[model samples]
Target: MVRARAAVAGARAAWIVSGPGARPTMLELEHEQLGGSARSDDARSTLELSRGIPLANVADGRRGVALARYESARAESASLARALTIEVRATLERVRVLERGRQVFDRLVALDAEVTAAARARVRDELITPLTARLVELDQLRVERRRATHAIALEEALVERIGWLGADAGAIVLASEAVEPESLTIAEDTIAARGREDAPAVLQARARIREREAAERLLAREQHGDAHVAIGAFLERRPSETATADDGGTRELGFRARVGVPLPWGTIDRMAVEQARSETGLAVQDERVVALAAATEARRAHRRLRLAWSQHTRDASRASQIDADLVRVREAYRDGRIGLDAYLAEKDRLTESRLEGLESELTYWEARAALERALGLSFEAIASGATR
Candidate 1:
């Protein structure tokens, strides 16, 4: 309820102070009327009217403060929205990575099961030891277990992310897509950091704070205590007994004017002014530090992680290619009785490990790219669209 009221007040203030068709002046009006009659006397009556005028400069300064506050709120809201977007994207990417990992594990399990079956058949024909068949079965079981663990972890992560988005668990249906490599060479770290300072919510929020404080200082300077001017008319009717002999029921009309001004107290006003100045100064310094530090830290850390992930991914890809060739040769050799079943099984295990490693490397690469986008205060789609 408090938040709702604040939102309503902010909207009203924004409209009144900054919206189109806003007037510079404020209008106030007042009216009063009275009438009475006694049995032994003539009627008596009175009427009064008044208007109030607010100082234009003071009013404008106050409006300026309100405008600054409204802008700060908007900046904060935008920052939160951006942060949430990054979180959702990162979480979705993690889910996708784990999903792909699970697929690799499934394939591994299936292949292991096939190898185990072949080993059992070989044992029945006295072509392989029973122990070899047992080892193959154990490998298959391990791969199955790993797949189950990965699936559970991925589901939990996805659910958590969906919850953060304020959606129902049943409503979320994640679709997998091809993961693309990040282009780190296109933009330098210093350039990205500079952009982050300009775009990051923390920096924007700090800058907004400084603006609001400055506006407050201006408002305090413009204010000269409190003052108002009132213009009105007064009218009265008197009974015959109170009227002069030449006048019948004396009637009078008069103009009324009033001006109110409070004596300015230097102590309190000076303190307020000083406080505003101090806050603005502090915010300015803080803003500079926060913007530079946040941008540099995120940019550098993300760049390093991305580069490392890319290198690892490249090596894993090459290793997987080599393993694939080795697996093909080993299988052919075992079928021709040139290599033992154990050697073929080892080659198959190596191939599985290479595939798993590649998946892990790809996952790390994607995660690093996502982190970089978050650090730079941008989204993958935005980066892909050539936005720095």
Candidate 2:
């Protein structure tokens, strides 16, 4: 292929030193026949042929003839090497993807630890109740741990699905890279928007109305039933007789046939048309209603995005300014610069603000994904509203 590409159109070029050659070899056949009943005997036949139909070895007849023989052994070795190289490259890429997935799960594990520490500190300072608060914190910890474990399992399964392109888990276990997550938020609007296709189910109840209309139209068409046309033909069979059949001089053969399409008149088709209309109306009406509800959800996501942007900007500034302050927010609560309740409230508020920022970013992506669905486009499918 590379050599072909190097030659320009109509350009004189050197010929190949060698090309692929055919091989003539063995052929084999086998046949067997047998009777199921004991009364009959079985039969079998087989034929095998080997080293057949060899081409003329030109070297025998042409003395001192210059012929190029292929050094296929070397070429075959190189081809094998290239194939192995490609396989290794693919394996490396798969390994890298799996490694990234594992890293994500590792982060989740670290986040669980942080949640634990925060709960302990809060309890020690009497900022939260020991029994109820501790129990709540434990539940949250378990959930986070489970999430991390589930992520690990999912990544492992993904590797297996990709033909186990890397070494075993033990060989590729990542070193711990722990960082606790400070925020958690859900994108409900995004979820609802993505599931909008369920709106089609609303059309089912109105299908009967459409069916009735169709039946009425069909009935009307059927009223004009049994419609056909007839025509006579004059033939000169055995023309030597001259104007025989039509002229009554020879025997006449009359052929009659009828063909017509039956219409439904106004009965059946009308019912069907009505049914279809009803079904379509119901489907459309409910879908519009559902879509309006969905639009509200989309607007909510939009509102959240704006709120998150504002809060994120303000909190980021506050955090930056407070970086040099020695007084811990928790200490402030103990010292009454802030009440215990007030400090916890502030901490919660700040944590949520940060989480909202992150969720807003995620919501943007999710909203885009949802919009694609609402507009009936997948990621690869170009959206009418989308710019290039």
TM values, all candidates: 0.66, 0.31
Best by TM-score: 1
Cα RMSDs, all models:
10.6, 26.5
Residues 1-388 of candidate 1 have per-residue lDDT tens digits of 0111221111111111222323222322222222332232233222332223334366567667777777777777766776776667667667666766676667666666666677788889998789867876776687687778878987887787778766664465657343343445446565456545655655565757757675765757555554555555545455566567666566677776678776665777677777777778777777777766666665665566566566666656676566465546445543645445555566565765665565656556465645544454553533464442
- lDDT, each prediction: 0.58, 0.41
Worst 10-residue lDDT window, candidate 1: 7-16
lDDT of 2: 0.41
TM-score of 1: 0.66
Any runs in candidate 2 off by more than 4 Å, and if so which? 1-266, 326-388
